[model samples]
Target: MIEKINLNNILFLDIETVPEYKNYRGLDLETQQLWEQKTQYQRKDEVSAEDFYERAGIWAEFGKIITISVGYFINKADIRNFRVTSFWGEEKKILQDFTNLLNTHFNGAQHILCGHNAKEFDIPFIARRMIINEIALPDKLNLFGKKPWEVPHLDTLELWKFGDYKHFTSLKLLTKVLGIPSPKDDIDGSEVAHVYYVENDIDRIITYCEKDVIAVAQIFLKLRREDLLIEDEIIHV
Candidate 1:
């Protein structure tokens, strides 16, 4: 059924995030100690407040979301074109630009929003930040009140689950298992903050995001082909 859906109707997106506060960095030792103390109060699998604060701190230190890489396969066309867009200024302005593009380019079209671990991270992170910045969210992103299965969300990570809920797979590992190149070889999520902060190299961040988007697209192709849901056509990567 996924193949019956037009490829152009899907938006493959990836985001880079950081924290909103700055002063927390100078107190790393104290912060870590406080985080350890706070972990006891959190649910077993949930992130502790201190841990979240630390991650936010790291994100703040690193210029947040230097770019968002998008990939889409146009309908009636055999080729896929990728675009890398940046949120280079204030967070609100960046979100506004992204929203404007989505509305102007993708409005009134039935589309599936695809991303890697997006349901848990990228989507929520962007939405929450947008809300914080008072940016209007697109209709497609207003799925917070909807039931899980009701949303037009396609997380490649979730698809990789293959009906087994307990089998956890990272995007990097999934790509490797599917014989696709691992994008993590060049840059990883952990180093993204450092790359943006220390080096101030936006190209590396953009490249890394682009690599992940490409990897996800490859995986989607593999699924469509091997699962017999789509035509056995060569993917024009």
Candidate 2:
């Protein structure tokens, strides 16, 4: 954790997603119609919903999570070591396993779930997917009755915004500007759909996802005016 936050109490997470179906044709006609109706604001007059279907993963209704990578801190001798774990493969199994981990280890009033752009995107996307998958929302993901001060979600993007609602920054951009190492060394989000649908490689996406988790954690440290961790301190679990 950065600042007053407990190191172990903060769980840094990032998700990788793809359209629920590989392509537009894979969706049933009724579902396609619904998708078209849902994207009326975003779809251009020249672009049919089918042409825009690949982008559905960005929206909760049309996409499924492929991976959820999380990281936490392990402080040792003035150095903070980060160990990350990932859940991928079947979306339902991933949601179940992630929820179990949250329930077992990070379920506390003090615990927080931190991500870049999480408040508007990741957290809500996860909740929406959990609903679509028929999984119960874990305590950290559910904010139904919590006051603003009680909400434990921390967003690096929001922190960077500093109450500037018009400001929107991507994780990659934040890491770069904040002097944290870029997480897109292998593949970026733009290529994720192609890599998942055409290459059919979940491992690649996992790697990218894990890198984002690490990047988010590092960005948090930077925001707190703390020193960055060396390469040896980053560990994979």
| Candidate 1, position 24, lDDT | 43
lDDT of 1 by residue, 83-150 (tens): 43444556677788878867877655487788888888777777776776777889778886888776
CA lDDT of every candidate: 0.67, 0.90
Clashing pairs in 1: 18-59, 19-56, 19-59, 19-60
Candidate 2 off by > 4 Å? 77-79
Using lDDT as the measure, the top candidate is: 2
Instruction: Summing lDDT over every window of 10 consecutive residues in candidate 1, give the lowest-scoring window.
Output: 227-236
| Residue-wise C-alpha lDDT for candidate 2, range 116-207, written one tens digit per residue | 88888888999999998999999988889989989988988888998899989888788878888899989998889999999988889999
RMSD for each of the candidates: 5.6, 1.4
